[model samples]
Target: MRHFLTALLVMILTAHIAIAQSQPVLNLELANKIADAAQEKATSENWNVVITILDQGGNLILLKKMDGTQIGSIEVAQLKAKTAFEFKRPTKVFEDMIKGGAVHLNTMPITAVEGGLPIFKDEHIIGAIGISGVTSVQDGIIAEAALKAVSLN
Candidate 1:
């Protein structure tokens, strides 16, 4: 019985290690890298925008507003990031649903708009990015470019 208990303990520890190893982590450095890429894209297009990054746990990691960007975009950007992180999908999904007559979603606590995207690493979401201060389509484009620049998918 002693030997069996020891084996079980070892198995539990091994499983814990594997689980930890498989989980993805996001930190400030990574968030800055992604925000930089997004800013670059916006600058190249002469579009001032606000960028927001949130960790998987819905914690704000970074927030940036390009020069001349509308101040209102700050909240919009954060809302977009929070919505994406909470839903585990692009905010565009909700936008599309709303356009398809899912108006009920408006009553929910979600920003059903474009410009929010989940940051994926190894098929797992580590964080999310949101852009505002430009057209919805343009914001989405910037977010996509940033993710591609960092090869985060």
Candidate 2:
């Protein structure tokens, strides 16, 4: 019985490791492309926004702050990106949930803002993008534009 239990545990651990290893990792090149796309969108709209790109594990891949953007947006943008990646959904979803009376959601260590979105490719979340220093809706628009660009790649 002891040997059987050990073998079962090994098999379970091996399968978990295999699945994690099979997931694609976000590279600097892709992060740059996403940031550039968001930058271009924000510039075209005359919006000075801070853009943050984060990997699937919620690590910062790249960050860019447009001129005239507020300094506070830097941290806000990073937090937004982290929230999106960690939660595997757009930050707006959390915000909406809280507004609907799920107030306990605020206790979590995440920024439930509309500016953050997960970047998906082939139905898998490859990374995330967050934009700030604009209205929450406008920030979401910029992140969505970046996501679209990433999808086309």
Best by TM-score: 1
Q: What TM-score does each of the candidates earn? A: 0.86, 0.82
lDDT of 2 by residue, 1-153 (tens): 999999999999999999877867788998998889899999899999999988867789798889999999999999998889888899999999999999998899989989998777656787888899999999999999987876533
Clashing residue pairs in candidate 1, if any? none
**Error at 100, model 2, angstroms:** 1.0
How many clashes does the backbone of model 2 have? 0
Those runs of model 1 whose alpha carbons end farther than 4 Å from true positions after fitting are 1-16, 20-22
Best candidate, lDDT-wise?
Answer: 1
Error of 2 at 2 (Å): 43
Error of 2 at 14 (Å): 16
- Could you tell me which residue pairs clash in candidate 2? none
Q: Write the per-residue lDDT of candidate 1 for residues 27-72, one digit (tens) a residue.
A: 9988999999999999999999999999867799899899899999
